[model samples]
Target chain A: MSNLAGWGHYPIVATECLPERGPVDIAGLVSAHPSMIARGHGRAYGDAAIGQPFTLPTLGLNRLRSFDAATGLLRVEAGVSIAEVLATFVPRGYFLAVVPGTKFVTVGGAIAADVHGKNHHRDGGFADSVEAFRLVTPGAETVTCSRTVNKELFAATTGGMGLTGVIVEATLRLRAIETGWLKQQTHIAADLDAAIAALEATAASTYSVAWIDCLARGNALGRSLIYAAEHASAQEFELLSNGRTAFPPARSARLAPPLVAPSWLLNRASVGAFNALYFGRGVARAGAPELVHWDTYFFPLDAIGHWNRIYGRRGFVQHQCVIPLETARGVLAEILDRVARRGSVSFLAVLKQLGPSHGLMSFPMRGYTLAMDFPMTDTLLPFLDEIDALVADAGGRLYLAKDARQSRATFEAGYPGLAAFRELRCHTGADRHFASHLSARLGI
Target chain B: MSDQKTVLILGGSSDIGYATALRYAEGGWRVWLAARDLASAQRNADDVTARSGQPVTVHALDVLQSEKFVDFVAQMPALPDTVISVIGELGDQKRAETDSSYAAMIMRTNFEAPSQLLDIFAGRFQARGTGTIVGVSSVAGDRGRGSNYFYGAAKAGFSQYLSGLRNRMSLAGKVRVVTVKPGFVRTRMTAHLKLPASLTVTPDRVASDIYGAAEENGREVIYVAKRFWLVMTIICLLPEPLFKRLKL
Candidate 1:
């Protein structure tokens, strides 16, 4: 349920794990269902955590089997949540080094997807922080893999997106922290160039990202909210909220009318109004370093649970593409120009800097990636293709992990690693059970 | 990704293929711009790098020489994510009708060559249990409008091939397949057509949506201007007797 995306609605199968306090028989389950799609807390934004026929639920498998608090080392089953890790150890002054957008994700999912965050520009993808993990391949064989052990599988499986096998247990590195709070600063950029400059200037100063207004045409084509932050000291965190038990309240969803409404109901007229409402709600000031909690700073959307329902029933498509930073300005301009030309209205768009990825099949490159969402519509393909070509000309690559409709030709042309990744798949003679609808659609 | 995750677009000089090459190059994988004219592929590669800041290599490829495709794949550091078939419609339907050679040329480029290259790509992708295949099939294939069904019929055959290839690849794992069914795209291919404002969509918009469908979601059959989906659906589902009676 947590991994559902706007592309399609599908049933979620549960994963299996031994509860920390359970008298469970691991051997029995392992023998019964040797081949399974292992999942953690199922917090993946896309299909990274779910499988169709058989899923190995790992949330209940929560248990920090071992931890050397002194050395910043932690050994946990694949199901341990980032929140749980922070709650259990942060009090004692330690934290997970690299966290994705949501702490709800499991330790295993993080390693499998090699998730990246705003700090990725400096820290690299999550795979950079991983110590090692236990993987159950499709052949029902379990092996511990790392940079040196089963190296090809290790590299491929890092960002392999669960295609290589299922992750059962993992040992991840922990970040020593003074508090669970973050020192955050937000700045507003006038346009795409200014926004990109702001991102570049502060990139080395701190973790950076910008929330762009995709529908902004002409001068404000890529207006953005640039944010940078570092972990706040424990004393500062304590003083900011006066040690409140919970985080900030979330913005409730203004639910739509209904599903299956006529597609015309969400046309440019409605979208234009929506865009105005979105853009007019921003703050003009900048430079105040607000003290914030881990959840608020990192997983802001998680607070507003089930936000996808806001799109109604047609669901939506998350279109994200990475263009080389050099051509980002021109490519983005052309893309936005085209979007405006086509009158495709989108409420919010985010543009961020992506450094080279460290994982084998990692998505981010040394470029700028922009993600925009629009309700599924009839004109989606041609409109999307126009931008697709722009990004391609800019030497951009699309992220496979998040794609729903990119064609096989575009993907093959976009990701040269597809064949290499496929080559690795050839060696592993497991059933084709590791595939996904996206993979099937793209012929991957 | 030792397979180079590299793409060598055959139509490097053309708009669609060139755009796709840049997209891949920017995403971090190396790109090989393969065009009939090696110089154009190189210039496109240089321009791609200038825009993307990622390295793009250029190669000489001739789809007409099907025998060279195997050799091309053999020399490639890796097989491409896909080989786009965006080279067609040079031979006008009316002209092709008057000249059999012109008609044969369109068929060879639109269907025969794509079939050859995909056969090679599909075999490799199937064995590996992972690969994506996309072919830009036009909405013209929806029905032989007195306008251009020769090219349309060729795209129709290519779309069918994609489905069959996808079925075969699914046995290994699954081959992601997307056959873009675009309406009157405003490209040089349809430059002469007095395209209706309502039916035409720009290249970037098509590229954006196609990129979305191909990379993010993997929608199997995407009508670029989604309205074309409805338009085509009605057209496909129209009463056959009544439709033929009107000479549409």
Candidate 2:
């Protein structure tokens, strides 16, 4: 047994770590271990991937099976990382129709979490692009699942946190692109109203996201900078003589911390200074348009490897939630007001607009979602609990992929389809054979 | 002509061998997996085919059954471009000290079976003028220790056999032979022990290192984790008087 933790690195658990490089190994592991969950790149922010006694790591099973150029369909193993897909197809004028903030996650994890990206308002969640997948059940059976076939299992497995079965492989539809660059436009919002107005103004863009200054007070409260982008077309790349045939853009080398830093390094004083500089820079660059690499525009934080270490050895909690569009402004204002009153400093605060929800347990709704990261502290849990109550009252639910702490009542109340989801789990025999710490904690 | 290649793994069900087989299959090689249990090997073959979109063939070959060696070679669909020998047994040192049969089993499994199989292929490759052989030895052969010296002795014998094979094959034809020594690999064989985190490596690292060495001709021996070469050099250089008193 080895000690393992999720991306957040909080509440470390001791479990038998099985490194599976193939479906046969996964089948053997599932049969050997009663309570086990499939882990891919360990990117889910909490205990969702950490079972009670077993964590079957799928990293070694990574392989690209096949690709249909005419249809833009790709068949890849469950452990294949998004970074691998991008490296193989980005230069060939293809891209993942939906991408999360990080490229380090695996296909299995993306489906299990049903993660949404900055383009959620237009592209939906990760499960939307998946055509079909193979699931290895605890009984050592490989079942093919798709929207039309094994409909209940398909619904339960998506956003099911690997409870339904171990994802073996998946076939996905890739979107064609003219180039590997994004044509980006930026706008500055002075306050909460201006920020929402900016989002509304650029709602038609294929991709839109905002960096909010969560600690801003009074008139500057909820100040943000919204970035909206579209895939660069041939005319947008007119600088290159060959237009659409221009060379693919190269990503800059990544940077990483040499070692873990002292826990006291990222306190309120330091974060406050950084936020001020960011806000000032945003104001100065209002309405600025630039052409950036797809990697830069979609995965900004990926430039710094193991950037989570900057949060210190104690790790950090990422709080992400979505509220109904009707109550978005009021709910967000209340949440920000509480954070300012508590003097909590979040160095990373982001906001995005979500489209209609698809997966049964998917986090998104027709609303606005905001995410923030705060270093774990004594008062952080209570503060988050308070925010959760506010979100639940507004009919908003917390994102399972990014949650490390949330009460059962809060989760159950937020997701109205929990009963149907439970029935599916029971029908699939997942309730007894597969379980994780998060599932046990929430009575799932 | 198509740029196609084929590789045969002697102990394909082993963790290290299976990982290496996956690497070869992913690189567009038709992999033939030979092991004691044909059913289990077929399952792994199916998995590799699914992952790589390449065909994989499974064969039954118990290393102890030397009498059937010639039949196994004759049944091959085509002469493999490369054949990897990843056969070994870590018999209990304590048991080996008491029973001669235990020690014999360890020696036969690690040294005799691999050497006999390679010798057969060596003759065919010498006549054909093209082939490669990868012998997976171990760093335990660098110096004798009370803990697992029997297993080490077998690997040391295999390493010497590979050295002789490389010399003769180089003089006769283009046939190449490479020996691999991996230290503290995380596999089912070492699952029961508590190993230091910094010193242990995954099977994938071993697979890539083997692939890299085979890609370049004239390479003789490869330390899976390259740092192991230096570590072994220091151990091998230690004075006999000082080394004999210490427990590893």
Candidate 3:
């Protein structure tokens, strides 16, 4: 057994990991290990993919099955990562319809989490682009699930957190683009009211996201800089350029922390200072339209490889929650206030607007979602519990994909569809065969 | 048109051979995996076909059967543009020291069989006027060692044959030959040995080096890790008296 952790690298768990090489291997593993969970890239940030005795790792099964240039439909193994997809297809005038903040996430993990991106408000979650998928169930049967076939299984498996089955292969409908660049505009908001106003003002943009200064207090509380963008069309490039433009060549990560940083280096003072400088820089770039590469605009954190090491050996927790649009500003302001009051500084704080949730356990709602990362400490669990209570009161759900320490009561209160999900799981016999640390802890 | 490149891999059941097959397949080359065990080669061919989305076929060919070698070449559907011979046996040193037959078998497996096969291909490739040949030798062949001198001697003979082939192929201008010398590699052959992680390289590394050598025109010899060239050079420079006195 080896110790494996999620992208957060927090709460490391010891489990026997099965390295699955292909579809046959995945089916064999499911039959051999009664208790197992399929882990894809381990980007879920918590215990959802962690299981005892067996964590089926799908990295080895990555392969491109087929592609139709005309329809833009691509079939790939579940283990193929977003990074690989972007590298292979972007230059060919295609892009993933939905992409999470990190490109390192595998297609299966993204589906399991039903991950959202900046364009979620416009294009919906990752599952919206998936046409069909092949899943290996607990009984070692490979079944095809899609909207037309096995509709209920389709809903349950997507955002099911690997509880229903192991996703072996998936077919995705890719979006065609003129170029791999975005025409971006930034808006600086001084306080909670201005941030809400900014989000409302830029609702027309196809892609929009906000970087909040979580430590800002008093009049400056909930200060944020919003980024709004859309793909640069060929006509726009023609008008702007001399008719000689080429797609931006994808750049690989060139920098990575060779070793873990000292924990004390990420304390309140240092993080606060960095937040100030970042906000100031964003404000300086406000109102100017800049053409930026999609990789740089969508996945800024990816430029620095092994960035989790910056949080030190103890790792960190990312608490993300979405509240109704009406109470979004008030709930987010209070959440930030509580985090500031606790002096638990977060190095990265992001706020994004989400459209309607697609699956039974999809994290998004037609509202605002705020995600923040805080280094692990003795006071973190209690602080999170308080935040969870406030979110529950506001009728918001804590994202299961990002939860490491959520209580069973909190989970029950958050997901109203839990009963239906459980019924489906029971009907499919997943309750008896499939289980994860999060499932067992939440009493699902 | 670029996807029409064909590469034939002998001893395709070996870890290094399978890795090379996958590498070539990924490069848009149709691959033929020829090994003694048809089942194992077919499995590897299937893996490459899946991973690279390229065509791969398996054929049965036992290198020990010299009489069948001619028929093996005749039976192939089409001659490959490039051929890679990755056949070797790391025979038991202790057994070789005690039994002369074991030493002869070691020489036969590592040297005679592969060179005889290559001797046939060398003529066909020269006549075709456009082909690349890669033979994987070993760094142990640089200088004789008491531990595995029989294996070393066989590899040394193989390397000498490669050097002559490289010279002959270079004169033809269209044909090229490359000799690959890999350091300590962590394959099934050395799985039981407690090899230092720092010193032991993976089969993937060796495969990439071989692929790289073929990519460049008229590239003669490749030390898998470039640093091995320097190490082997220094070891060869040591006086015979000093080298014989020290145990390697």
Please give, for residues A227-325, the per-residue lDDT of candidate 1 as tens digits: 788887656666665656432333233443444555456667887787666555545336667776676677776675555555556656667888987
lDDT of 2: 0.85
Candidate 2 residue pairs in backbone clash: none
Per DockQ, the best of the predicted structures is: 3
For model 1, what is the alpha-carbon lDDT of residue A116?
77
**DockQ of prediction 1:** 0.01
In model 2, where do residues sit more than 4 Å from their true spots?
A1-5, A12-22, A25-38, A52-80, A84-94, A136-142, A176-180, A231-254, A258-260, A279-291, A427-429, B3-62, B88-105, B187-212, B237-244
Report DockQ per prediction, comma-separated: 0.01, 0.17, 0.20
Interface RMSD of 2: 5.5
Worst 10 residues of 1 chain A by lDDT: A15-24
Alpha-carbon shift of residue A335 in model 2 (angstroms): 2.2
